[model samples]
Target: MKKFLMLLLALLTVMVIAACTANEDAGEDPTDSEEPDTTEEGTNDDDEDATDDGTEEKVLRLNNGIEPSSLDPSIGFDAVSWDPLNNLMEGLTRLDQDSRAAEGVAESWDISDDGLTYTFHLREDVNWSNGDPVVAEDFVFAWKYMLDPETASPAAFLGYFIEGAEAFNSGEGSADDVNITAVDEKTLEVVLEAPTGFFLDLLTNPAFFPINHQVAQDNPNWHTEAESFVGNGPFKLESWEHDVEMVFTKNEHYWDADTVKLDKVHFAMVNDSNTQYQMFESGELDTASIPPELSDELIDGDNVFIGDYGGLEFYRFNITEEPFHNKNIRKAFAYAVNRADIAEYVVKNGVEPAYGFVSPGFTSPTGSDFRDENGDLVTFNPELAQQYLEDGMAEEGYNELPEIVLTYNTSDSNKAVAEALQSMFNEHLGVEVTLENQEWNVFAEAQQNLELQFSRSSFINDYSDPVNFLESFVTDSYMNRTGFSSAEYDELIEKGKSETDEEQRWEYLYEAERMLAEEMIAMPIRYYNTVVLEADGVSGILRHPVGYFDLKFADKN
Candidate 1:
């Protein structure tokens, strides 16, 4: 598992290479933007917001793109919610600046020789934002709640490693059957079904965050409002204006409060990239994602930062629906997409074209990238695509393909990608694909219900291991929005989980990726990259390639 740190170094190298290439291509010195302008007359607005003792009040402003689907740790599994929840609450472990799992609420832990049981000792000094002491029961309650069949948490699959977790979530066992126990006020014990190499890394996900057991019992909607929300992390929910904005104040009662430098964090719900960039330029937002149209121009700026992001932008084909129900049809659609063209022209960020589900950077036991070893399984082949489409039509006994509609969440980037895909289908296979858009919350719910015939989707790694990516397609996995079920695929993933030999386990995962591509359950577009511009005088904000943002140590002048 220590090999996961190699991904951090690889991402750092990508950052440096992207920065230098952008500078060279533009023929402009990025340092020019770093120089201060002596012509400015008044002190910066940030300086005016000082404390009573004449000390500057440190605040970091950002844009969340859209209103989060929910603030409940178990429910909000997407990137928009993950960013805020990561700072507002913490799990047993947290990702540090080096992207390794470090101690957080748990001060120490003991693992059994068999590696199936873990005993964690929590910090006695840790307290929730409401001044309530954090205890072992909080974790017990939260994990049970997430796995309770009624909660219908999309992230419940992440906890399947725990003994009886899958049975409880699938309604085959009761909550009492689960193996988590609060051994004492400060100690928690958990038993796993098998030895998991990346178990600690999995705990860093927000889905593992502990909840205030008493507070949640009293108010079922505790996470929906600022007054009722209780967290034990570096920041506390100060105010929320629904879809407009949210403000977070530093939590004085946090165990690591002394190390936190920012006084507050302000997040705006701006869905448009162009408007977000305008806000950053006008001093309303401290950080913003670069707009695709302006990426070439702003990518060379001194304040711009680029890094590898561990995620994939892809489209899901509902196999239960007509036309797509045919395997040849799905393969035809996947091959028709020109991934390289979309990545360069539509995305405009320095992202690699994805030919496989798992992104690059996971180092195998024999020192090889999982993606490179698997090689390119899907590509742009117009002749093959047309032949497959005709074969599918013949198999379905249809003279013409059925009308297809592609749906995506409302956003400038999503719209651009959807349009590009529509054009590709028309040019390569002569299929006219209609496009539709919906808000994030509605679209996400619809996709989960398997209502969308074809739709846009994304997957960010919940853990550093390659198995984290391959397991999503297992039969009945919540992340498997596509109605794809294969007994052979399911067996491969199951064997990979319990296989202890690193080489043999990786072989299972590699075969799984090849099977997914051969079936073409989903179309891969590009691997994600972090392209953002930060305001001057801001630093120390950590963005892990495989995890969410860490603003605990961020500072603003």
Candidate 2:
């Protein structure tokens, strides 16, 4: 760990020096350039490759880790789908090069003084891949469909702030109660239940992306195949080979097509990190995630790029399952594992040991870090673990504890972490736990159905706020797979969302996190930090700390 830190410091120093040198050469202040040059064309004077027309065809190759679970914007909420979807289709707002919410389909918007209503005016020139003009009805239909109870979209909870959306999703109200309307052909009006400061930021999520109502009506499975997919973003899905690869070509009809630098973006569905690293080395992929086992060896590599990522790696205990049903037993298992060792020894990718659900990097109204404000709530303590196990056994009136299984998806890093956890449980609590692994799709379905006892999970922030992490545990949230419910916790989260006073809202969030830790609802192992290797001459790829990749402005030599 110490060696890794030193190397990171050296890399930062080199970057600073390079930035200063570039600024001096350009005779401009470093702070003046806060965002990258997204409007630049890919035509470089030093380019060597040329076609018959004497123009080079620019393409960017990447690995998606696995085939997207689904291409439907509302259904594909995980990272595997998000990265490609973010480029293939756009929402009302898109994350800019600086990771700030910027206009996409919406040319401009107006908000009422009460902050309850938002009126977005769509860009007149924005057209889908099929050359159909994008209209406000697309947004309205997509939003209502996402909130429809029959759709069963996992991301439905994200739209709860919309007036009557929660009720409609819970089957207590009709779609008319959703409070979204197409004021005109290009105007979309939405009313929120309460004043939300992060409404624009929330719209950056792919779940809020618009769907072409006409296309969907003509074919129900428009998003399943590239030929049928209709998108109004910088890129359009050109081809899709399930579980193999996908190809995206620039959308000539895009509103901002002139700003798109690359002609094609190719995604290879390779789940193994080491294999991806090898591909990147052999010039098959432009960027690849660093495998934990090779982190130390590659830390000083010139191609490596490390940045803060807002997410958490954790394990969820199904309260309805045996052994984990008791709160005491859950706490026993949580306290038995050493998170620091896992972050340092097992997943050595510059991640910080996590003691709270919210990853570090969020600032409160008081200008303090949310994680630092809430100190370590859970830690390794073998003695406390033993005591809690005994108390839980006594409470259950059992001479022996029931068998427990730690389930995870098939991945090299996940397997390593699961094995380390198994050893820790056996050593600290004298509990012999079994480990199981399954494919990504199968495991995701099982976890969602609460079929797994204790399973590995992760949460990436959809917005730049601490509440995004806290809201996942709400009793009615589809993301809440642990089967743990608490009226107080739910109320606290409600207050956090509805409370107007920033300070008081933060107070609610802090209290809710405390309650979660006190009950040991989930065992937090580490906070994520993105570590990837990018080949030379690849630039302008926007990797937002709280969001997915933005390849619209990316260029390759």
Candidate 3:
């Protein structure tokens, strides 16, 4: 029994020693066996740390107000396009925070003493997002494209300052006759028909922006999609989901890309101010326009801002149509509205009743505002309105008034203003009007097609010049959706454009403004106020006086 016990103990000890040896063979070094700590945050190399909570940068959330009709600079002519284009593309010059002309693609420029010739020196370091060198010929191509009748750009009139541009647009001259020339790869020269003081300011507009010549030639639809959308600005289109949201990512190839702080910019197309405000409250938006319902409560708040946007809200009569064709009918409709009440009640954001087309911010030769110099030339007098309506009714030989349709873009604020105008027309002129609402693009198309009798419209300056407002009234102006034209008005504006003396030019413009008010060209409603809501941590955002809200210079805290 003793011998058997000893042998079993030795065998057990041998088995234990074999198990220990196997464990030693399977063991690993501590440095190699320790698990990796993925929880320690690390940057993504693909986007260069564009993650939401990364240490590098945050995305800027913005509201575009309306879905832009097109991203093509030659095709887009309104604030909806201009605002985004200002960041996505650049002109020879661009507007700074104060709406002053600033250097853009052109590093510097020299202007002749007569102001008829401008020579631009472009930066050699600049290239398109696609890596193509941006050259002077690009500007020449863009200018010619804008003036080409085939392009049918609504902003074709903007090219009129160039020598022979009018003749080219009118089909009387060749595109080659337009005096824009590329002296070299880095130099661009422009010759104007007359000395224009605001030429640099005009160049800041998107109509004068450059396009990649090869890209445009390769794909006519390149601008319509993100995959093909190439730009040379601080931001480039990453994704464009039509009518919903547009996303812009920073262009790593931009010459000044180092200065761009935001990783991306997201533009949410929320047409309704109420919806935009809700998004703002939900932290989905960084900026929004104050809804008319919330205007009174938020107008004085710290984040709410009111801008003296150099624009006027007006309802234009389709002068080519039946009753509106008569001057007396148009005048009667113009005088019928109580503009002050509308401004105070309907659009309660800081908008003032606009008695004339020119808003109050423009300075005259004597340093007084043009609007202050001409105070309320078109007054609100119901008696005169009724009398004029009666005369129009008599002239038309109609005992029954025609049904008028007032069309406006879809929005709570627009609907409110339309309802107020409807009530005013019913009360003051005994006219029954129908209010029609459509989406912004649809309404814009209808206006462009002249399919609406009366449509709500507004003019934000393309530049600070008064001609930017008055030029739309010219007979052939593509911006003239109203079809209201006069030879005298066109002649006066032509003289104003060429007039060199400051006082003389202002006098011409003043006369034109008087003519507009006296003839009751359109039913001027109110001058626009900025009226916006800004979230915390947003700084350096520029709300241009002409209604362009840009974020290229903005920073997110």
Q: Candidate 1, TM-score vs. the true structure?
A: 0.91
Q: Write candidate 1's Cα lDDT for 262-331 as tens digits.
A: 9988877665555556667778778877766666778798987787678788889999999999999999
Cα lDDT tens digits for candidate 2, 181-274: 9999999999999999999999999999999999998998999999898888899999988767788888999989999998887887665555
Best of the two (2, 3) by TM-score: 2
TM-score of 3: 0.89
**Candidate 1 local distance difference test against the native:** 0.81
Per-residue error at 256 for model 2, in Å?
1.0
Off by over 4 Å in 2: 1-52
* Candidate 3 runs further than 4 Å off: 1-56
TM-score of each: 0.91, 0.90, 0.89
Full-model lDDT, candidate 3: 0.76
Candidate 1 vs candidate 3: which has greater lDDT?
Answer: 1
Clashing pairs in 2: none
